[model samples]
Target: MEGFTLILLYLALPSLLFSAVKQILTWRKSLGSKPQFPGPRQFPLLGRVHDLPRYSLWLKFKEWADIYGPIYYTRVIDQTFIIVSDEKIAEELLVKRGHIYSGRPQIRSLIRHKEGPTYSALMDRHDIWKAQRKWAHAAVAEAYKHHFYGHVEREMRRYLGLLLLDPSRFLDYTREYCGRVMSRLAWDDATQGRANGDSADTTLHCMSVSGPITNTITPLWHLPAFANPWYRYEVRREREQRDWWLSNFRLAKDRMRRGELPGDTWAYRYFEQVKKEGNGDLNQTEEQEVFASCMIGFLNLVGVVTISGPLKFFLMAMGLHPEWQKKAQAEIDKVCGGRMPTIQDYAALPTVRACMKETVRWRSGVPLGVPHQAERDDEYRGVKIKKGTVVLACEWALNRVPSRYPDGDHFRPERWLEPGWPTYQEPLTRYPNFREGQAMHSFGWGRRTCLGQNLVDDETFVFAAAVLWAFDLAPKVCPRTGEPIPIDTQATNSHVILEPSPYKLDIKVRNAERGGQVLEGYREVMGELRL
Candidate 1:
């Protein structure tokens, strides 16, 4: 609140009020002519914003879906939004007609550099987005598969080592583990990786919430730097973030030059490919450098936030439903024999894989996934949708649609393992894969789907399997109450990513023999994979 800014706002307030009223009148005039989409009652100016709950927003959307029949309309102020909770409609619009629905809401806070937009997620559908995305995908394609698996396994082993050092820090260790692993995957960083991760988490969290202005409104970003403290803070953070990641970018490039990092490392290989794609002259342009850094930066954000989410949920699932945990461990033991589980055992341990997928399905990372903007006017099921309407694929509601998954409340892995359930598929080895964008709608849809899901799948599965194999999870017992604390599945995270509320896990080695084997196996692998 600045004196000059306030004076200007007040001066324009009367005209702004007039425009708002005019917009409302126009909307009301058209209400009767168009097929009114079923949804909560909209107010005079606030739309449905007044009724929106502060937490568990997906639940509220699901409740509305139940009342309004899958598709519904809601608005915040003058901005209209379509909440699509039905898989078929979501698929039809977000996937089938993706060309019209792949655009993202252009938030004013995120800036564009020479390479492209600050973040790929915020960039609307275009050639630059498509090209950057193509390179992103190619960076993780077949040539990099073996390196990907190795990165996952090596990092998982280190995570388990830290867990052995202190079991009480499961949540902290999981978060750090993801940060370190993604950093390694991003740029082969053995130094200052954690710092890079911290900056990424903070930077993306700001991006997701649009920084301090999110709590206020978008107009705050329009104020002069001296007039807006939030804008000043954002500018400061962006400069720091750019410098931090640019250093990592240079380090990875240096490592490649000095032959310190393996040729197979993601950082090494990706840069080489980019150079090849640019016809052997990288030019080292501002766009090239920033694009390279942000590619890795985005990876850091995605892995540290979203990847940690499912693991937290998996831990919670084990506490709430120990039966599935037992089955998973039993499968791991059978598959690995006496040795500790490895990525190679991934296929053989279908129950272990099922547990991981079930937790993700049971509790999606982003319940109301990244919003997609309607690029043009469209109609669906006889209801007209206006161009520029923000469309959200309600993943939570879609996954819990009674007809699709009847046992939605429980953490049951059998749905993925056995037939007769809608989620089931043949060949247990590959059926639960998260890379199938068409089959798995939790991540995202069509052209805008999350990249590097293979990284998430392989890395997360290895860690989840290792945790299940190495330890037994139960709700921590309260000494004073003399009862095990009840695990609340409804606990949630406030950020864009959805994870279980922090809870202490009662973890223990299944047996002394297996515990020793776990440590010994990790030591051997650590020796081989030490960077």
Candidate 2:
């Protein structure tokens, strides 16, 4: 018995000693090699997880930026994060070093499901992501060349008419307009029927469910499946979402088989590409996956929700600051001459464009741009950033840099106008002769920049311009008090996409004749398109 006890002790001793040594080394590393960047004090093991705000996380991050400067480090659980609030540093890391920094963090909850691969934007830097991005960019560029803006213009007219009919349902109209336009861009036939009705709702639900869950409790992803029921639920939800997208794909495929393929639609283009090029380097499943992914991705993530927030914000801006609305309307009237605002008038309506720019800058839908993961261990400004560290381009902080945007919290369109105005440019790149600065980070930076930015910009400008041309948007008056209800610019729903909270706004046509003109324009556009 004594010999056996000794043998057991001998075996356990070495293993325990090894673990002790390893832990000591880890502790020393943690203690000796502290992060160079300043941040809130971190508790041992937990880091700043408890310090994080459950609601309005972006605002909290912005607050931290003010305290810790533009670049700071924080850890939640075992994951390290490098938050960048400055544009120059963001550009350096996310753009110039994009090859290494564009990798996406693994949110196991988001990708554990079978359909996870379909989320092209959330995908890690890999061959699959490259292929999906290539195909998506091509599809969007093709749609642009095919006069997709014409589709947007037509939809804006219809949207304006819907608002005129029921001003109270402006939110629904905005969301529905986005869905209808996306459906037209994705599947031309689907836009004419019931397909457009529930898509926006479905998309909103999917995002609302998945986004918060995936972002808030990412550490749970490390637990075994049996240990975490939430993981199982999300996986099931994702499967349903995958099925929805597949169903749409099948609808498009069936249409193709019957020789009813719609011209210039993304689905049609994809079908032809597969038939002609034989899926290129990808297998049939991958090809189908890419097609289905791009279709759903663009329709939901980019096409629908991305623009809805900005549209809502634009309306809120109009209601909150009637002066800016009047300025924009004047510009629209000058360029469009009482006719419906068109893309052709874009170059002439600088003030209208400036207003659009200011809306994006003031309250970006995506305040904290999507997280980018470090591909390899790197350093910035003498601060170490380990491989797999989550990098956040904190747009909420970046856009409100005090020097660039005075009274940054205030909604001011004039800041984007002449003389001392910021040099507003697309793609967020600096250029010579552009004086003040640029406000482009709302979309994102570098290789991970929003592929649909041009579409968003063009559509937003056109929609905003048309609405300003057609209506005098104002705050709703209280029937009891007879006082105008204050528009709370800060009253926004907390989500990955910050949307304007439900607010009452009185939307009226500038003139009764203008309402008739809008309806007539919608009829004429529909007739011309044979919709």
lDDT of 2 by residue, 326-368 (tens): 8888877776786998877766777777777788888888887
Ten residues in sequence with the least summed lDDT for candidate 2? 427-436
The digit string of per-residue lDDT tens for model 1 on 1-531 reads 443546545544554476488677877878767786888888875677656664677888899998998888987656788998888888899999998998887554555432354567667877767766786778777534674747666777766766776888898778777777777667766434456556655764565542344332444455557656756777788778777777778778777667676665557767787667763534487767876777666656666777877888888888778788888878887787676577777678888778888888888888887889989998887888878898998888887887788778767788888988887887887777777622478778888888768777777778888888788888899989979887677787545676678787788878888678667766865766433
Clashing pairs in 2: none
Question: Which stretches in model 2 have alpha-carbon errors above 4 Å?
Answer: 1-25, 113-116, 189-214, 219-229, 278-300, 424-437, 525-531
Total colliding residue pairs, candidate 2: 0
Best model per TM-score: 1
Report the CA-based lDDT of candidate 1 relative to the real structure.
0.73
Candidate-wise lDDT, in order: 0.73, 0.71
